[model samples]
Target chain A: MTNETASAYPGVSALVHKHLPKVPFTADKTLTDANITVEPAHFLELMQGLKERRELAFDYLRNVVGIDMQDEGLVCKYQLHSMKHRHSIQVTVHTPPGNPHIPSLTGLYAAADWHEREAAEMLGLVFDGHPNLKNLLLDEDVRIHPLLKAHPLQKMEIAQGIEDRDPGFKF
Target chain B: MTVWPEERLVTADAFNTVDMTINVGPQHPATHGVFRMVLTVDGEMVVDCEPYIGYLHRGLEKLTENHDYRQSMGWWDRTDYLAGMACEMAYCMAVEKLGQFEVPERAEYIRVMMVELSRILSHLMFFGAFGADVGSFGTSFIYAWRERERIYDFFEEVSGDRMFPTYFRPGGVQMDLPENYEDRVRWLLGSIRQGLEDFDGLLTGNEIFVERCRGLSPVSQEQAVDWGLGGACLRSTGLAYDIRKVEPYSVYDRLKFDIPVGKTGDVFDRFIVRMAEAWQSTKIIEQCLDQMPKGLVLNPDLPKTLRIDSGECYIRTEGTKGEYGVYAMAKGGNKPYRMKLRSPSFCNLSALKQMVVGHYVADAIIILGSLDIVLGEVDK
Candidate 1:
């Protein structure tokens, strides 16, 4: 948040927000040199660009986590570092109240696999391209997201109807 | 590679070249405590290896959500049972940072002493396990464990639990060091040094250990960095970067110690790095003891329930294994709506398959041993 910390990693904001306008669903942008905040859609491309460019080369995907904001929904936050550039940035993908989904960054970072699995299991966020989409740190049959503000009871008969009615199911 | 003369072992026929599939535990000795690895093998050489975790997953993350901030300290102790004090310290620092609580100088010194002592104990386990993996078996392991027991005694005396010491609180340690603690720790320091000397004679210079370890599983520095390796694993790759040095959390900036590195990132280099680090940890404990102060162990300013004033912060600290982080978001509520743990072993273990690719099956155990993963922390 301080100027010194911001200036410590110079030009990070420009590098992150270069392709920001192209992406849909972006929120308020904090273009500090140390950190940047972009919407979830922009986050995927920003990570992709960071990986390809030799100047950026943010190869190490350290952590991906989901945070529950009450009244609001889940926020998927990612921390990335370029060991080559000696810089770090945080990206957040905010999801609204009822349904939370974010583009899976596992293709960009293999370490994102287990982390995405953890987030999906904990917050019920469906990652579009995760290789293994099963539960992590919880039983497979768990019907509720533990980290949510409301402890969603199974209401078995009704919940099953909603799950079955999901239009994405081709079968 | 010459094939064995037996036609049944060497044949292309399915009936002759029968490769038995074995599930080598949620309880195998080499799987390292409740970790199940389904191995498909062809006569002692592994064709495929699939690691299955969660045998020790007691849902600590979900369980912590139900408890208060103070109550969560007990759960942190159980996560990394080997480096229990480090786990306690990391979680405590997260809560303190969130609440803006300041620890007394005395408590800092005690924590430094206790954590360094635990670091030595953990490295000893690494040594013992590495030796056992390299086929020295009980000879070196029992010797390392023998010295480690004395350090456990000191932990028990202070924290009241030998294995999992829930001694660190939000702002400081649970209690002051017990009477005559200095004498006991000093004695341990000497005894552990002597034990290291004996351990060196048993395993370090021996031809078998040298041959099995020297050139096997050599991870390039770029690969290590790409995989997010930390602690001794990163140190062994000539990085010379330690979280204790770069990040400077706790009293690490004030303390003086060398970050040992290796020329070639092999199993032997890892062993050397850990051995040298044990001596460095001893040096740190001595300094912490010398600069020991007298004050309150817990901060009186810290509230019983932590309700940080409307914000989110991600705090990271150097655990004995690597960077153990706690990400806490407070909506000014008594319990956190979200808490994410960034465990080091999970990242380090992600690199396991890559490290073992070209190496023989025998060398895989040694490679994993060098990584020094605690499965509980890895799965959690």
Candidate 2:
């Protein structure tokens, strides 16, 4: 691990290093909270270790956000808090340009169910093993990922037209 | 051959019934604000539940990403419309954290006062609406509105609009409190306390309301934390883990108040916790009034157009409902690269399926109401 990453949250970094020394983890600096960036390959194992470790019991999955980096790839961020320790950390997972797949945390945290679905529907990040990864906060039939940077913000009339459905009878 | 009325004896298998699906609200009043849930029932007991949202999703995050930092304040307030100021505070705090803006000391106290008042406003709404769900109907709603209107009047006097004030800026509030506001708020508190007493007599003191909610859907502290429940719902389970107390934000550290926890995390516990929390909010406001210093409300060093080189922060505040968190990332621009609201109502509502699965159909509605979910936040 880099010095900057270790310095962000020294206690958590020390704990992560002691438990999962083999995992290739790097630190990302943020204005607030300890953030660590990891690849999709090591995502699940690292998360499991974080939760199972007695001293670093990050049991509560606070928030999940998916960001689209046009050139790099899609990013999935998970904010976790240990109710026991009251310390929080942000986990960042990046998938290559076309592959937006990451392991789901639904098994470990029940809170991941809706959050993963929301992330999936919003930015099209696929969470493998999420039981019902259907469209959330969107129509069941709608397949578009509105949050992707490629998707333009259109006017209401133009957006309605793009859907290619019937504009019901006018009065 | 047809059996006579008393001749045939009824066996357990004789009355076999098929499971039925009942759809409640994209419009129903009990579901509360454009939320819909499909419940599969074995007679009266709900076997399964699937909630449908997004009818009100206006792409809040998308809108925030598109607009300037200050321009998006209007949309954030609408998330928890019942407590608009509380949502604004979270949004502003996130912006301030990312930009490293210093808010005037007076503004912090004012922001805390308004947010606490907003919390009371939200809890009163829950009290009224939950009372209606428990069969009190219009009486409780009217009683809640009596205090709510008085509070709204104060809000309107401070800011032009009542519901979505959009009064908080990144560095501070849009403007200072109105002159003579302290006297008005003191009078309002007296009226609000009386309103709480009336609700106590009408709902809490009533045996029917007590018995109906007492043992319903009890949640353990571990279960609450595992399910990511927050606010009164999590506290009802005896966790005593309030964001305000555990992680003090704004002026909460200076204030003196008690976090009311419940013995059993049931519907009744959720109700009582919120009631006690509302009472505590009044105390915090009174403290703000006593300790508030005279100074500028907005930061003097703020630029006309705020810009940050690059920074990211997840700021969490004790929203009226729960932990209202904002994960903000700014990358060399007036607008943030990404802003995500970890709305309390959304997280609290996510565990509805587990909470409502084994309860009666009527009781499921009560469970949903007890969660005190504002759909605007959930769908956003």
Candidate 3:
């Protein structure tokens, strides 16, 4: 983790550092927001502290993005904003190569319902406590994760078994 | 009247009312696009609403991931089809941030002006559509089209296309504004003010419209923030959290504008807030015209084929509908490693079930209309 990136809200990082000393956070060089990487085991606990702690007060769940990190594993990235402090942070959670289970934020933030579903369907990350873990932007019965790096763009038809013929190129 | 048999006589309690399910639009006009919702109605009141989207799902993110940085601009504009320029601004800003490119002063002003115009265009569409939803039908739509057509004409003069004007490049705009663009936009603004007054008198002053929308589906600030509502929807809840004002990206900090807020955050508040916001957008455009410099629109130093060594950034802009945020990441490639759109319409639409339940079936439709969701943005 690099300390070179300056935070837009220095107070936010200071507050986090003071409160949760164990949780390591790095300032994102490209963006102003602070970025934290947490394991699936401590993900819920860290998120709860980020929300419940009055100083942190990350009330808004801005976005959830699922990335297929190829050999590393599947990653779920969350952007959270504190409406009170007007500060935002990005949380990255990595799951094991085969085990893509992350605790759901639906119980904590109401906005997580659809975001979790979208992430779940797009990258095949299982949100453990998500009430409805169905496909959002994809078909209900379509079980393929389209956003994975392994999933070829042009060969979607062939992959889905819609066409028997082989399209030549592969990404 | 002849008396019926005692056993045949019906009592209110004796009637068995099974909740009827009403499926509205994957094709219907009222849905605004290809969005469908199944409402479980116990009589007139909606017990539950299950909104099913993705009908217009084009795998925008997946497509962006596969394509080069510049190649994905067209798709981003299509995400918010109504305000294509606004979406383009967000997309360009994201790419620019990832590459750490500097836009020219004149270009920034031009970009702001176009985005504000797009905002008005989008809000005007909402005005017309919401009026139609409230039973005014074609009258309001035609009123909206009058101004929209003029704006589109201006847009066409500036850019080649009317709707998806891919006018914005990563570092700046495609080109400078047309020579007579200033005079034309000034006249357009005057006409827009008149159009706004027409809407105000037609809808805002109408007693029936007010009665229908007032006190319907009131959302608190907490609810708005919790459910991830943005733009007019969140502002109507009285939070005054406009990204343009709060974050002040591009030239927004240099310009001056007011963030309109509602008292109760009800359906009427949402409508009125958007009306006021449209007026505010006009103010912004006027300022941009005044402050614009004379220089190159596109940065000269930008590479022909844009490539980033390694970086990640989440760029948030005040979209016409809400907070249009783009999360971009590049790891030593010409194509972005991952590009995720934190689209406001999608978030606003997610809370539909919570807001619709307990409202009358007709009111439920009104509530959905209040959200002002573009299905393109929602299902991106």
Candidate 4:
């Protein structure tokens, strides 16, 4: 971990790699300076550790999002920031096609509870160990996560085509 | 603070009290939107609570995947309906970051003024709702919205729409501040000050209002820090962390205002912090107007459609509630590979479980009100 090459961008990404090892952590050229990507397993450890540390405390759990990676399935991302350092980092864990599960970070950051639940219901990622995991943004009667690529909209019969529905029927 | 030892004091058979689960929204005005809360209660004490959202979720995330970046501006308005401008700012910042575009100085100043105005507006709604929660009745609620109407007038003049002001874009604002904007804003600011002073006498000093909120729903400094509460919610806990000062996005660093703090981490403190913040926001707008640069609003060099080629960026700012952040990933395309919003209400609402666990059932609504959540932001 310590033997890896140092990050060239010594601003936000510097603090990021400084705390985590070089196993799956890698940087991609993005808008601001750099976009640091880490493995899901390593991400959980890095974030949990970041929450505990005093000097490098990434105390604020800023945002959680679920993104469809097309062929790669869904990638659940967490954007974490530090109130003290004025820096930010993006951590992502990929869920496999169809069924997906990741260890919940609600234990570490309580904010992750609803986010994980939303992601679970929206993109179909099972957040194991979430104290009260349930469908947040969708009804049980309405099946399928609309955000998922594999979920067939036509088959679900939720959103009818413009041609299929008669508006004037008023039923 | 009594720290109970880690032990199960009540067994399943010993529990004679069963919590009555009450579903409180998807229709109730207090739920704030098409959202519902499942409150499990024994008499007036709440045993458990769960928030149900997505009644208004129109699959905007999926819709964005089909539309261009410019079209996505409309969705930001729907996310945080009250603080639409802040959402627009965050979205614009993310797009600007992704495209490596810059907004003109005049645009930046106008943007700052607009966001500050929106911040005041959101806080007004918070104060009104919080007052309503505690039976303060139409007095604070009416006064807050009445003052908010002036700001909406300014919004209507600037952008054709009053509520959903989709007045921001990647390169800059949708357009410059309207003609005679300085006069209107100045008048609005003066009106807000007078309204605030009247509000002070009518609601702030009222004995009943103060007593209901002073110590109820108290949050310790460590608890606030641990829970990741921000904006006025965090300030009520005695921490003076304002992203405008700390991170200093846009032209905020150029301006000056004190980030108000409270000594006591209670509902009263939260109210006090927000009231002071409305004044601070007014001060910010005054400064922006005084020294607002005269130039183009949008960056002339940027192209029509944002083509963010192979990059990702997370741009954030202190919205009315807290840290409103946007994460954008572009893979050499016009449309974003993925766009994610890290909403403030979502983070603020996270503290509800801890805050209400030990308090009475009535305090649950007060705590939720103190958190100042917008369901659109929460569900997003």
lDDT of 3 at A23: 68
Cα lDDT tens digits for candidate 1, B110-227: 9878888888888898888888888989987899899889899888899889989888887888888888888777878899899888888888889988988888778788777777
Residue B131 miss distance in model 1 (angstroms): 1.7
Residue B312 CA displacement from its true place in model 1, Å: 1.7
Residue-level lDDT of model 2, residues B51-138, one tens digit each, is 8988999999989988889999999999999999999998899888878889889999999999999999999999999999999999
For model 2, chain A alone compared with the true chain A gives a TM-score of 0.86
Residues A37-59 of candidate 1: C-alpha lDDT, one tens digit per residue: 55665667777877777877788
Which structure is stronger by DockQ: 1 or 4? 4
Fraction of the reference Cα-Cα interface contacts (below 8 Å) that each candidate reproduces: 0.22, 0.66, 0.61, 0.53
Which candidate number has the best lDDT? 3
Best by DockQ: 3
Which 10 residues in a row give candidate 3 chain B its minimum summed lDDT?
B244-253
Inter-residue clash pairs, candidate 2: none
Residue-level lDDT for B189 in candidate 1: 87
Docking class of 2: acceptable
Please state how well chain A of candidate 3 matches the true chain A, as a TM-score.
0.86
- Give the TM-score ranking, best first: 3, 2, 4, 1
Judging by lDDT, tell me the better candidate of 2 and 4: 2
Cα RMSD, each candidate: 5.7, 4.0, 2.7, 6.9
